[model samples]
Target: MTQTDRTDTAERPDPPESSESVATGGAAQAQSQFRRAWTRFRRNKLALASFVVLVALIILAVIAPLIAPYGFEEPDYEHTLAGPGTAGHLLGTDLLGRDLLSRLIYSLRTSFLVGFGAELAALIVAVVIGLIAGYRGGRAEQFLMAITDVMFAFPTYLFAVLMVAVLGRSVGAVILAIAIASWVNMARLTRAQTMTLMQRDFVEAARAMGAPGVTIAVRYVLPNAVGPLLVAVSFGIPAAITAEAGLALLGLGVQPPTPSLGGMIQDGISYVTSYPNMLVWPAVMLAVVLLAFTWLGDGIRDAFDTTGTRR
Candidate 1:
């Protein structure tokens, strides 16, 4: 109504208080989302079973020395290649007289470490590249897609084998090889999700406000895209682990004295007629690990899917 009234209205603290309320609401929403996701995940019996199995394997791997009566690399000359139920060897003895049980436990640790590490590396690279490429579109998207196509054309196993051959047999080489081969899927998944998210109302609002490209992509796009990305990651770990084992079985993964499940299984091929425990334990371990990841991924997919059943 007057100059003083105009000044008073302009100086009112309502806007700041409103902004604070909005920020608080956003934080509450994020926490609620995480809680709902966890609740959904826990309700799935198969997923919970997988989580329990994963936790058990982790515990076994962590306490390998205590749980395993003998060292992974220790050789019992008198008990070499003993079948299951041998005097001291629980799972039996390998061709080298080493304890199969110990090796199996240690192999679990190595498999998980390599798988998780490789997947994480691939995931980081894929998410970053895919988000940027998809968000920017045009030439960047085309170029990235072209490169992804090229990668997809080559068989992953062949690429990994070649990389391992060049890099020599070692844990690091195996991890790098698998990561290189595996990242394409992650990249594609992230790109597709990012493209979809780019059209959402929040993103449009951010664009209207003249927010930076990076800010919009990171703040809005990535959060929405993480659901599928997590599913991809869950499956990726087992894939990497199996890949590593396969490579090692072919003598391109990890070298001897390293005690890898693949290496043990490969060696067991020679003693299958004499002692079956060597092959049995490794195969069982691999199966368990794969199953755990498979169930976990299914659980995660269900957790995020509105149409998915709770169990």
Candidate 2:
């Protein structure tokens, strides 16, 4: 206990924090980030309302069979062309004597399937191509980007129409056609995000540690890029829905016996001067779906933007 010894002991730094504490701190930080994003999203009143409506619409589509008053194609000979609030036919019957409400409900299901299915297919293609192009760069990047550029050169909707025509009109074909047309945007986005993230300190450290490229891309790069990716997906869903509807309108969508919003609109157009409800209901639903996704996408983009603040 000499004076020099006492001074040396007092000047020594505290021990490094435990691994458990570091893990806890990381978890806390992630939670805080999520909370902040959610708070920002909630501040957007229109977006919040749209999200609720979107969720309700999804639920309705899921349970359409249970809630719809009658089979989508069931003909009510006695109630042909019945108007709204007609006996047993809530929204009335179509030209074929089928219930409008049931067809609309089933049509919703078809639209959602196309939207989510197409987007998911596009996402898979985009992430794989984008990640490889960005992470590997050099010749790989050049080859992949060239293809993406070619896709970008085409008008997306027209390209989709051509693909649908070639592939024939079916739900699966429509989804594939839309995916082929739509994936270029997301691929470019993912590539940019991956390249930017690859330059980050953590990613560089992982590279220095001799981690495999796939491991680094999946473990570090992908997670960091998820926010922007989610925003992109939110926007893409509506685009997919719109494409499906347009195809259906043009008679190149899912074939007969499978109802779709666009098909309903097409059917209603001939009867527009007669029973307008046939045209109005499906059009209104389509408009609502488009608006809801657009608002939600904007909200998500704003929320994830660290530089922006929503008042």
Worst 10 residues of 2 by lDDT: 19-28
lDDT of 2: 0.89
Pairs in clash, predicted candidate 1: none
Error of 1 at 239 (Å): 1.0
What is each predicted model's overall lDDT from 0 to 1? 0.83, 0.89
Model 2 misplacement above 4 A: 1-32, 309-311
Q: Find the number of clashing residue pairs for candidate 1.
A: 0
TM-score between candidate 1 and the true structure = 0.87
Off by over 4 Å in 1: 1-31, 308-311
TM-scores for the candidates? 0.87, 0.90
Candidate 2 lDDT by residue in tens digits, 1-311: 99999999999999975544543443355466668889999999999999999999999999999999888889989989999989788899998789999999999999999999999999999999999999999999999999999999999999999999999888999999999999999999999999997776666666656778888788777777778888999999999998888888788988977899989998899889989999999999999999999999999988888985644
